[model samples]
Target: MSAPAPIPDRHGRAGRNRPGSRVWLFAVPGMTLFAAFWLLPMLRLVGVGASGPSGAMAYLAVVTNRHYLWSLVSTLLLSAAVTVVTLAISSLVGLFLQRNRFPGKSLLLAMLTFPLAFPGVVVGFMVIMLAGRQGLIGALTDKLFGESLVFAYSLAGLFLGYLYFSIPRVILTVIAAAEKLDPALEEAARSLGANPLRVFFDIVVPALTPALISSGAICFATSIGAFGTAFTLATNIDVLPMAIYNEFTSYANFAMAASLSIVLGIITWIALALARSLSGNSVPATA
Candidate 1:
């Protein structure tokens, strides 16, 4: 039999390469980029972390050193808190926006997502303006009871900054996922005597679990590594990002900085991995 004609590609070029032939070449650039950017830097970071006077013990500083340990713990706790709060708030707002149509809906969504335009630094600045010593909240509190409500340089401020940026991304995801939800399922649940909370938990949550997991993981990772916001408002908090910055810049402790960076990246990876595993999909590592 004569050979079949080759399949024409979009460019009208005949498909000349056979499967398992030059397919591997397509991955060469990706592999090279990954190695040059990620793999090599990671290896260098590990080496630098071990090359200090403390040797491999530098990596252990996060646990053996009180300051480092507390910094890591605080970062993890703050990131977790941000993830939970962001998800909860996003869930409510996303459902409301998707399920109901109201006047100024577009305007409301635009306002809700307006924070996405602000970088971490801008968000931090906004928090300071809203809650700083001379902020409106402080002025009001001082006027009312002679006590200014100043928390813009504290962990609370950091949390608010993170939440401001995180909610836009997460709420969008929730709205997109919720768009695919089967209303009949909810109606059936309601018809079967399920209460509001029960129907929500049993019917809605499962449908949105994948999106929630992925977005929560991204939010957690962003909070964990959000250096700009932390740098701006880290006056009273010891988040790991600020600690790493101090080690690298203030003390020139390359080993400690490298170790902290490695630890932070690993923790972020773990969160993404867990989310992927739970969602049965490859969750992205970006916010």
Candidate 2:
């Protein structure tokens, strides 16, 4: 048999390049961007962290210093609380909205998700308006018990604000995931004598685990790094972000600020990393 004709250069001259070279070509821009934006900044941050009065051990102050350590702990706890509460509320609302039909359902959903449009500061202000000293709750309590129920400048207010801001995004994620769940699986579970709770835990929860992991990670990261809401409502609390701000702005301690920032970033990274490892998917570094 005659030799087959040479294959046509369907992918063009560039396509004739080696696979490794092609990969480098495609990857160079992204790698360059990553280095410029992410890697360089992180390295500089590390350097700054080490440039403190204590030298390279400056980052240790995040744990060694009582105030800084407490701030870090409080931040982690708040972020975890926000993640759990947001997941719980979002899951319920998402499921109900997805499975049930009622009057003005669209309107209700739109209203529920309207918080997504508001910034963190706006959410804090809303919290203040609802629970601040002169807010509705305060007025009601004062009217009923002769005591104002003010909490808008404390950790409680920060919690409420974070929850409010986190719920909308999480609800959207849960709703999207809920819509894709197979009703047949739920039905099959019921057919097999599984009760509502059983079916939910066995079928629905498993199916939605990935979404929950991803969204919870995002919520945690957001809460960890959130500055605006904390700035607006953290009179009694010392969250890490606010601590970093105080260090950098109020105390003019660039080294402490950089160290705190690195510590904060490391904690956030660990949370996302764990979620990704468990969920087998990519998670965003920042919310």
Candidate 3:
């Protein structure tokens, strides 16, 4: 029998005769930029931390510190709450826009997404003005209820700020998913005597799970890493990002900050990975 022919390389050339041309042209600039802006800076920061006894010990100390752990726990709790609220609100809004005909629907969606255009710091300031002790809603609530409903400088403030950013993201993602869903499935459920609630729970909700997961993951990651809003609004509260900042700038402890950053990065990665995994599993495989 004749020997099997050698497999062609990427350009359909034989192994030894492959072109010497650079195949990394597309990747070269991006990799270079990434290294320059991200990877190199990260390495330098880590090196700075590793080089000093105070830095390294501070990092270890912060990681094992109960205060740091509590801050992380608080941050996660706040992030989760915000994600849940944003997901629920955005999903409902998307369903309304996609399925029901309402007046000024486009206008409403545009308004909902307007927050995405605002900087987080600006959003935080606006929220504080609206919900602070002397602000509109807070003043009204205080006058009517004889108690301040001021949410500024608290976990609630942070959550509200996160929701402001996250809701728009959720709306955009879920609306796209909603648009792709076949309305016939919903109609069939209705024809089978399924109530609106039952159809929504059994059919619509299941279909939108992947989008919800994705939006939640995005919201969670952003909330955990958020600095602007947390700095502006939640000064009284100690969230993870704020703690990291304090460790880095106020205390001048780069090692502790690095350690905290690594922890935050790990958490974000895990949440995103879980979201992707869940989305992949939920999506039906096509031929």
9-127 in candidate 2: lDDT tens per residue? 65643333343545668888999999999999999999998988888777888889899999999998988988999999999999999999999999999999898898888988999
- Report, for every candidate in turn, its global Cα lDDT versus the true structure: 0.92, 0.90, 0.85
Q: Predictions ranked by lDDT, top down?
A: 1, 2, 3
TM-scores, in order shown? 0.91, 0.90, 0.86
- Model 3 agreement with the true structure over 19-62: per-residue lDDT tens digits: 43557787889999999998998788777766666756655765
Greater-lDDT candidate between 1 and 2: 1
Least lDDT summed over 10 consecutive residues: which range in candidate 3? 14-23
**Highest-lDDT candidate:** 1
Candidate 1 lDDT tens digits, 155-250: 999998898899999999999999999999999999999999999999999999999999999999999999888888878978999999999999
Once fitted onto the true fold, the runs of candidate 3 whose alpha carbons sit more than 4 angstroms away are 1-23, 54-60, 281-287
Clashes of each: 0, 0, 0
Candidate 2: global Cα-lDDT?
0.90
Counting only residues 3 or more apart in sequence or on different chains, how many pairs clash (N, Cα, C under 3 Å) in candidate 3?
A: 0
Pull out the clashing pairs in model 2: none
